[model samples]
Target chain A: MSVAQISRNEAQAPVEQREALPLRIVRRLANSRELTLFVLVVALALAMTIVYPHNFPTGPNMRAVLLNLAPVGILVCGMMLLMIAGTFDLSVGSTLALSGVWAGVVSGWWGWPAEAALLIGVVVGAVAGLINGLIVTRIGINALIATLGTLTIYRSLTYVTAGTGVTPISDSFAEYGRAADPVLRIQSPFWAMLVLVLIGGWLIARTRFFRQFYFVGGNPRAAQLSGIRVDRLILIGFVIMGALAGIAGVLGAARLNSAVVNAGVGIELKVITATVLGGASLKGGEGTVLGGILGVLFIALIENAMIINAVGVFWQGLVVGLVLLFAVSLDRFKTAGRA
Target chain B: MGSMLKSTLIALGMTALASAVTAPARAQESSFGPADAKETYYWISNKANLPLFVQYDYVGMKKIAEELGVKATGGRQVAVVGGWDPSLTESVKKCIEQGVPTVVDDGDLPASGRLAYIGTNWTQVGVAQAKKMMEKVPNGGKLAMMSIINAGNMREAVAGFKAYIEANGGGKYNIVSNEDDGGDAQKAAQVTAAILAANPDIAGIAGFDSESGAGIVTALREAGKNPGDIKVTAMEQTPDFFKTAKEGWVDGIVVQNRELFIYYAVKILHDYNHNGLKSAGLAAADGGRPVPDTLDTGVLLVTKDNVDKVTAALGVK
Candidate 1:
């Protein structure tokens, strides 16, 4: 791995390439999709508040929205990084099943400690991601194609191992997953997700190895000429995604107190939708962890609002699809001149 | 000598032709008998991804296989074409390749060459659910339904529901909305919530899939309505569904008799394989006899009266 040669510069860029004064303004204007999304999200929240007057902005509803965002929230973190690195991992939803069911086996059946089981689940997720990376990089498969195949394979494997039902585990396991402190006014996993987003977002924005990821995604030939190990960086992105998805699966199992079969089903679609809605480019080379998550929150808010307001759940895809199309179109418009 | 040999050959050819003409009668008898080779039976479902329901049917079939000292293992087909229709064909091909006497669930394999089909008559299930809904909401009112809308299983159930409602309620009852939840819990919750929000006057909601029950209950809870405030007739029972039923959060559920469906299939295939069922007077859909093409496993409505029996029976909660 060329990772040993890569070091974190922490606060400074390795190369001193500065944007010209007027160009900076144009650059910001061209990439104002996130800025527009941020405004839309704020406006949506306000509109929801106006409609409900009482329930929309309540603490309990906020908790629900955050909890709903937790699984996909973690996913958007990895996806943003991966997307920024110019690849994708669609197998996360299926890997979630595999990771959760396997942990249920180790912890509940094999009588391992919950912590150890959780660790093992995360490791398995990492391995699944590693395999995905290898297929895409080493075997010369496209990222989308590799992950799409694994998605079905992993989900089927979960069914083969855990069967097609919820495998209930110990009560203690559920505690870790669903525990809510009355004082905090939120669940344990909600706080954990907040911490993950904070750290993950910081790393992407600040770290040297991660900064190189943008170049790899933006242009592989340029990145290769610049001495960046594009494949390894992409592989790390997958591992991060897999690990986060694993955590989400284990948490889901714990919350249900059962190993759920289809817990993460269709989540990849949601994560991608939210990511794109949050302003990540499908062509790669751009996105932020916080921005992607805001998009997640926006979608989650809409879903919660739908249920809260009596909107048709079937319309979620239509709404998200339209929003995504709008966001991507705006992104294209912004990048047109630069490209 | 050549003329004598030619005559003999012609006589042998005549004898072969006579047998060929009468072969259908003999072929029928042996066809009813067991195969000379010892092997296993196959049961693959198109709706195999639905683990809660699929696993139970497979286990029941597996139990029968154990009793007969045969083996069986199956999986779901990836919904590639026409949603779920392809699964049936794919499973049939697997069975054909294995050369096993196969019984398929979902029963809509077109012409995939299966011994027989065994599963809930989803239309009948809808009928039963509709019947239950009418019983609950005797005073006709607005109703809602939550399902994948286009799924084959849900398609029949939805049809039956609409048929029963239209037939029974006349113009008295109205279906407010039949929203698709896409088989996701969160989506179900959101859909249920929205449906309830718009139609606060909604008298009954037919929770047509396993996901719909909890979604409906949770939305009701979130909306500050008692689970019993709305008349809910769920189509399937899972562990969570049991909790909702017990808490009076779910009014009743139409439990598909999957065990009966799977076990009956095992018995039919085993009986066919072990002996000449035809010789034992098994009518081939003829002679005004008892031979039938499909078995409706039927559904049980688990309400307050039978909630205990159902929950204890399932041992889920």
Candidate 2:
């Protein structure tokens, strides 16, 4: 099945028809949550183009939109997987801080190469994720409580580690994050996020390994009865969440050119909001990486539009909250109509 | 329990209790004010997680307090602080409850029954930044402001900035946008980047807080724009401000000296307690009028020409 229909497809597939490319693409689009988002995005983009012909449509502003969305896009991949598996990672923002700060310490203070610092950051993220997995899987703790504990621990660690003001990263490393494509004016992180999305989408579609995630989340007892290693899969899902947060942290610190202690504050809330708005349910087994990435794009567009229109900065939060509410309500209305 | 162990436990408990008391150490009643000058003084700011600058201000208060053989009190270590976290109203209530000689800083709560306020006038800080911006764009330019709009000081600053532009900017200095960064460097960079993209003609930025320069500089650097491309005036300084300012990303800095702030806050309270408001020169003796409730500790405008000398003199670098 295509990624867009991951846990939502109700009909059993016919071997012959499923093999047809045109049929599969059409079938997915007909039911895809992402299609609605794509339409909404394009519509909004066009509206913004008309309203802000001089400002919004320019290369620099468009680039800012993409750059702003890049970190969120990278996060959507792992978060989507975890959401589909009936789990949440509240500590992702704190994990991002912990990873980024540690990597910064090694690279900047300890005088290690930037590459080593980057690796350490990603590794720290993986370890942090693995710990959350162990607590939830082995200790039978609630994912919420387990991750909440890690959240406090990690954010406090960020303060302890990054507490001594801004820890400057290597100049070259920061410059690399800012490097852009000449023609498009889009930065490297945006391109990197696109690749992650493609890979994430492919993982959900082509592999039975990924397909089992739907089974595990959609019906854990059934998945276990079918001999799926449900615990191991959940563990891997959490690991992916952590590692991705790590990648985002490295990019975040590099982009800002310093390890900022307050950098990741409230980000997990934003990521979770974006994930749910993208059509994921907290109950589990109902989201797409594609939808989540688009959710990132949609939010960035709103922020840009609000600023260009000279709306009060305080209204940005209210608008975002309303969008989230609207998106959830639409999902609920759809489900109720189906019933 | 063994007798020796019991005694050791008691000793440790007593030590912990003593240190806890010392953290918010109440001073002995000595001769109060500058002349007789030995007493405990309390400086209460609104919040507990004191920013670095505020800490420096408190340190300066301590320096003077020591010079006069007195004690300076209240900081993050003080079990209770009046920042907006729990509401300054609650902190003020606590001050009244504990009978702490509280001197409110920056933010005023006469309703909280504060004895006095020692801090800069935020509106003037805003005016100073606007003046700097105006000096740069003598012919006018599209200007954006990065501020924390809801912050009490920021509200004053924004009001001052708007007032100045209206009165003197001659329609040249246009306040096209106001972006509240919520003190997030990353968000600041993103907003700055967006403002630049949208307003290609944007010529200057007035940054109203500590992190604004850091965020603006990062955004400008990534956009491949030089500091010369835009005139930037900001409040406070960050670690990288030294290089960023010298390189020209920051045009002028409005410095609110923390030392002078704490010194005056404590001294005013001390003088008031000793000789009364009139004797402390906080009240007009001739007219029986009140000294202005707010004190503008004042600001130093540091530009490229004097940033080094100023920062060096301030010992910030």
Candidate 3:
């Protein structure tokens, strides 16, 4: 080898080796959406804890915040899945109301068993989802149009089925939602959300069957040519989303012991916001369940802090929207830096 | 023979035409004659999905429709149930201009040229709520009021509540926060918890919407507080309110005369349609007759003692 080439190699080797380990770790964290969200969530919690030690970090406040964010967190798992597969459901809020109303009717009015009520609620949600899936997969309608149409239709059905909603929906059924852990004293809804997030994260990150969704979302034509059942996977994704909404609905109704006809109103936007903030893109195939849940946690903390500080309700939405834009913009910088 | 048949047919047609023209005139001659099927008395309202409307307004409309023998149509808009929106005021003005008798419900727009408003006097309702709170906590203490505060009627209610407390509370009652719950039960519960956490010395809570009682009760229960730990007075007589009050989770409720509002509003509009301006002894101005400008539907205060009586009278059981 020539001395000139040798000298060039020696210089390049030194430059590469001189890059510090800490700088590399920082770059890796920046590149990872989930890690960045985790850090932000921890940082926010620590800040609130230090600033409002008496109110923000108290047991009752923590429990309330967790319980309140449970429904949105549960919905995020399904939304993350759909977003990863390049499709989404706008009818989740309506589906939740419909499911909850049915549960109320069965247990409160019809004298059905609590278990049957729960099962029926979930089944109704699944059926609603099946219709959405069939419309999109079989009829070839866009996911947005199909879900938006069903959103109104399902809400109307809920109103038709029970106009004023059912109150005092049986004490036995309410226990399912009211049950809490002894240590944390957090409600069942929060626990349900935690379990779902863990299982969803594992399945999407490690399982080969679920990984096919990433391929389908990335390139549908290529995925189809590769013998993947793109339509079937998308359909399954919707069913799962529907069932999660059902679970959330029943749990919420049980917690309040009332099946409100307007339950879950305008929740679709919040779920989508968290999902996008968690790293899921409209283009799809890029987010994990962990990132999505962390996004929910961060938003929930911000809201809790605002409430603790006695901020006006009008300002909460603006703050959340700005945070979402800022988080998404960070990705652009990270990508540019990588290039 | 054909000409004779044609002449007979023409005579019959002329008789039918004359009868048709005279029928309405004869009907108009009576003070309150039977209503024709085509004369529809529309009750225009907003937020038709509210449980109050579902339970009372629609049911009352059905009864009035059957009695009056006229098609009772309720034109409902899903948006803007409260506050004074220019659009709603304009709509009422246009109705008056078009010679449509419009009576507002739930919230009133006085400048809209509406014939009448058959709903609670929001300020008075607030005063009533304050009285109930005072009764429960006679000495008074720190309090929190929750409602959709941006709404015009709600603002009036809050103002009335504060005024009553200030005037009659002997300076004992203190309201620390007036939180907006967005008229949602779940959001109400969340805000209630936050309020409780922030102000531990809170002695009472006043809810000024239908969804408030359930939310307040749920929040209290979740916080592990017992019945009567914090006095609560809410508006509306919903089934959930009945259940919570019966269980001693709620102290008192100020229920508006909602059914009466619907029942009387429909009857008044029906009477106007049949009787016209002359029968009511009123002059028509701007193509609209002056009827009752504001009808105070009034309210009923329901404690645990009187809840059963009120709910029973309303046929809630």
| TM-score, every prediction | 0.75, 0.81, 0.87
User: Which structure is stronger by DockQ: 2 or 3?
Assistant: 2
Instruction: Please tell me the TM-score of chain A for candidate 2.
Output: 0.89
Measured by DockQ, the strongest candidate is: 2
C-alpha lDDT (0 to 100) for residue A336 of candidate 2: 53
The local lDDT score (0 to 100) that residue A300 gets in candidate 3 is: 85
Each candidate's interface RMSD: 19.0, 10.2, 16.6
- The residue ranges of model 2 lying beyond 4 angstroms of the native Cα positions read A1-31, B1-87, B259-295, B310-317
Fnat for model 1 comes to 0.19
Q: What lDDT score is found at residue B268 in candidate 2?
A: 61
lDDT of 2 by residue, A211-268 (tens): 8888888998988999999999999999999999888888887777676655677788
User: In model 3, what are the clashing residue pairs, if there are any?
Assistant: none
Tens-digit lDDT string for candidate 3 (B168-260): 989998888788876678878988888887777789999987887788888999988999999998876355567567768788787786766
1 against 3, candidate with superior DockQ: 3
TM-score of 3: 0.87
* Total clashes in model 3, counting residue pairs 3 or more apart in sequence or in different chains: 0
DockQ ranking of the models: 2, 3, 1
